[model samples]
Target: MQRLDATDNAKALVRQLAETHGDLMFYQAGGCCEGTQPQCFEKGGFFPRTNDVCIGTVEGYEFWVDKDLFEYWKHAHFTLDVTDGFGAGGFSLETPLGKTFQVHYRVFAEEELEKLPPVKRNIP
Candidate 1:
């Protein structure tokens, strides 16, 4: 009953960031620049656009996805993963740390759909 999750690697990175940045949050803009990569921020730093969907959280950090994209991905689940290497052109917190936050997604099975938690929709 979840829409978002994180790999152990991602969780460890978040902890490291939190040590310096305090609480954190994330947004996947689904646009150019970051190009759909999840951007991490100090909690409450990046504001959510109207209609952004709160898919879920990891380590208490809220993770949001652009609503328009959510319409296309409504049936898919997301797992936040970190990759080794520089995040070219990405502005996420992790980008400066030689990492980029990316989403690994898959369509939910019928059984999973039924158990999925409802998304918290933002109205702006």
Candidate 2:
């Protein structure tokens, strides 16, 4: 099963972004002004460290999370969502469009945990 997903609105936004930006990627920020928010960028805009985890894909774009943050959130499933405003850091591509990416999470069920897909830690 996939660990990450996106809302209809978010998918649409990604499509819009890809049309203009070519390709995209997402990284779940750990802290600082970004405040654990999901930031979207041109595929190579923000590099994923070796220890960062690629939980899954959303709209065909890799969705990665910080290693320590991933450890803290290991039991949860994430859904990427979009909202109609600016995020704190304003570093995400959507921020310029007056939108921001957000993540909604739910703890995995016992059965789900058993079948959950393995996360990729090696950055490609």
Candidate 3:
């Protein structure tokens, strides 16, 4: 019932990253360029905005969505996915390895919405 999930490839990549970096996290912003994609970082590496939304976790790693984006996608499900490419102007851990993180989303069904997982509305 989580708002966030990850693809097999994403999970594997994050696993490898966590092994090397200790822990990992993600943030998806909203905008025309860099904000459109997801960014991966070593846990605690990036400072989230105060009002960022913690959508959920992938492989136990927290995944946060920008406050503005979360408002637009509050009823959708998000899945973390990865693709081969350099990341858009970001400091994401995967950027240096010729890969970038992406987010795929879908609307939550009526039934699914009834038991949707909780989200942290702000970083606090």
Q: How accurate is candidate 3 locally (lDDT)?
A: 0.85
Candidate 3 residue pairs in backbone clash: none
Candidate 2: stretches off by over 4 Å: none
**lDDT by residue for model 3 over 3-71, one digit each (tens)?**
888899999999888888988888888977886788888888887898899988888988888888898
Q: Which has the higher lDDT value, candidate number 1 or candidate number 3?
A: 1
Model 2 lDDT-worst window of ten: 115-124
Q: Give the TM-score comparing model 3 with the true structure, all chains together.
A: 0.90
Winner on lDDT between 1 and 2 is: 2
Query: Candidate 2 on 1-124: residue-level lDDT in tens?
Result: 7788889999999999999998899999688878889999999899998889999987788998999899999999999999999888788899989998999999999899999978999665
Candidate 1, residues 1-124: lDDT per residue as tens digits?
A: 7988899999999999999999999988867676777889998888998888999998898998899889989999999999987664566788778898788999999999999877898885
Model 2 Cα displacement at 117 (Å)? Answer: 1.1
Per-residue lDDT, model 1, residue 21, is 91
TM-score each candidate.
0.93, 0.96, 0.90
Q: Model 3, residue 73: displacement in angstroms?
A: 0.7
- Clash pairs, candidate 1, are none
Residue-level error in angstroms, candidate 1, position 4: 1.1
Best by lDDT: 2
